[model samples]
Target: MKTLTSLLLPLFFFAASAASAAPTANSILGASDAIRNPGGAFSVTVTLTEFQAGKQVDASTLTSYSRTQSNGQFASLVQFVLPARDAGKLMLKNGNDMWFYDPLSKASVRLSPQQRLLGQASNGDVATVNLAKDYTAVLSGEEEVQNGERQLRKAHKLALTAANPDVTYASIEMWVDAENNRPIKARFFADSSRLLKTAYYRRYQPQLGAERPTETVIIDGLDPKSVTIMRFSDYAARSIPDTWMQRDFLPRFQPE
Candidate 1:
């Protein structure tokens, strides 16, 4: 979550307000037969590395939580270390809330929903995996793909965009399943020139009763040199109690 997408949107626009409807797990999967976990619970452990003008700079871990079928409803915790600055922690919520907890002061900055402004917050545009509710989704095409011995149907380029006319990313391209409508791969960009980032969903196995992406990869863009690659491990799909995600969890991780 310390990657570019996490900070990019919140720093740019305010979070999307509640009341708008979100997409169902069926629709978000991208194809009718696209694989998805039943009941929608998931978790992962990720590693992130920072780069400077392509040089390695820093690295850390990212913790994630989410419901399989819902959008803008996930949480991410990130760790950052630098040669000069003290290490820091960053937390983000789909409702457009982000918290910055510093190890040096043991203090945190909680952004109000009003002041917590960022453009890419709503549509999952700024993050690696988009789960926004307002974007227009399109099933562009299809292709035959084989993974090991399994021949899976991939929904080619299922694009989605915000309804607003003036936006940064013209479209988001994703490959999903034609049968299930679940996404296998997705890409985000600025206009047609710059490829900001891409996410790869793999190591998908059955958990509980459905299939889900246990492993994720996030590619960094041109600016903000420090991190080059970020990936998740210890992935799982299961029910998570709300009590485990309290706002005050920040204090528990404060360096003593």
Candidate 2:
């Protein structure tokens, strides 16, 4: 009986350890998204700066309001704030469709998620969407990565595969902080599996009832000298009406 009990104890402990070590990919992705979006309607200003050869080249700013619907989807309205020529330009995202409106032309044109916005940032980057709802996540492993200060930080590495055709990136490799579930780094990939860009989340600040990354720095995958920094500020809860989410309402909509 003693011999049988010893064998069973070892097997039980091994199984328990394996179960604890393996975290479900969906749960991890969901937790990370919750930290980012927080399932509420809010407003924020994003300032994008472009750099070339380590020098500042150009910059733009935009204000956006986002709200999550009952179906777990997001609706957002974005209006360009800086750069006099582009001021009053509006972009609206309703589910998978994105539309850009120009006041001068009085036209609204459809846009693809892959289209570039400033430098490394994309039109899709401004859209408020939950990635966990769009992609299927697979826990690849965990590793230590160097932070902005060159200090080692442990993170859970995840490989995210797009479940449908509407997503911006076909596949994404992301690293989430092991303890807080904050996304530390991410690599965006094209359909052909080519690396498009790399983004690093930094300068975490309290916003919309949670601590979130206030700035995102993106680097060009092919050209290491090119960089873009997006600074987020003025986060507050706002009331976004249903009329603002419709594409046909773009001409009549007015920014508050």
Candidate 3:
């Protein structure tokens, strides 16, 4: 009996340690956020490509400048860089407010984060955001989910609901890689509980001192045939001034 007790004692201790070390849902979300976004201010060029039924339709390029606020939120300025016709157009996200500026009209119009920018990509999608700040997360379970490469990966599924009204989506179901805490996939939903889109973060590459997902594939929830690919490149640490994030500065803002 003494020998059996000794053998089981080590097993019990190991089990207890494992349980205590398990990450909470909020911590997992925070880790995933760190993997998705770089710390501090930076700039990256984004190319959005739209596809319908596997056929290419439209494409555009934009440069996004982002700065982290003292409150741990992001303020962004996205400028349209491609297609001469749309050149000089700007979108600014400051706190809960979002605005779109058109140089032609010299007008800045209020916009919603849910507004579609390109294909299935929303105005919120292109901007720098930290999900852990905007939503409250709950761990659902661990499961095997299909990745962007069509391979199965063990992921931690998390259910998230908006902590405030200023978020892009009302609720989201996300899956993060269990091993690395990298974001795998997410399903975005509207306030009416309607499915909006599904996003898969894939194509990890070295960018801005970390291995971040360089490409995000977004699929329309209702129509899987409609897709948009958002590719990130030309990453560099940049100093974004406070004036740049202001809507009034959009007209005078000149790209350097």
Tell me which of candidates 1 and 2 scores higher on lDDT: 2
Instruction: Answer with 1 or 3, whichever has the higher lDDT.
Output: 3
lDDT of 3 by residue, 220-253 (tens): 9999999999999999997888999988788899
| Candidate 1 residue-pair clash tally | 28
Model 3: pairs clashing at backbone N, Cα or C within 3 Å: none
Q: Give me the candidate number with maximum lDDT.
A: 3
Ranking by TM-score: 2, 3, 1
- Over 74-186, each residue of candidate 1 has an lDDT whose tens digit, in order, gives 44444443323534554544334555667667777764322211211222322233334435776555666532224566545566764443333556666665555555665
**Predicted structure 3, TM vs. truth:** 0.93
lDDT of each: 0.49, 0.88, 0.94
- Summed over model 3, clashes come to 0
Residue 75 error for model 2, in Å? 1.6
Count backbone clashes in candidate 2. Answer: 0
Off by over 4 Å in 1: 1-42, 49-58, 67-72, 76-88, 110-134, 143-154, 163-170, 179-182, 191-193, 217-230, 236-249, 252-256
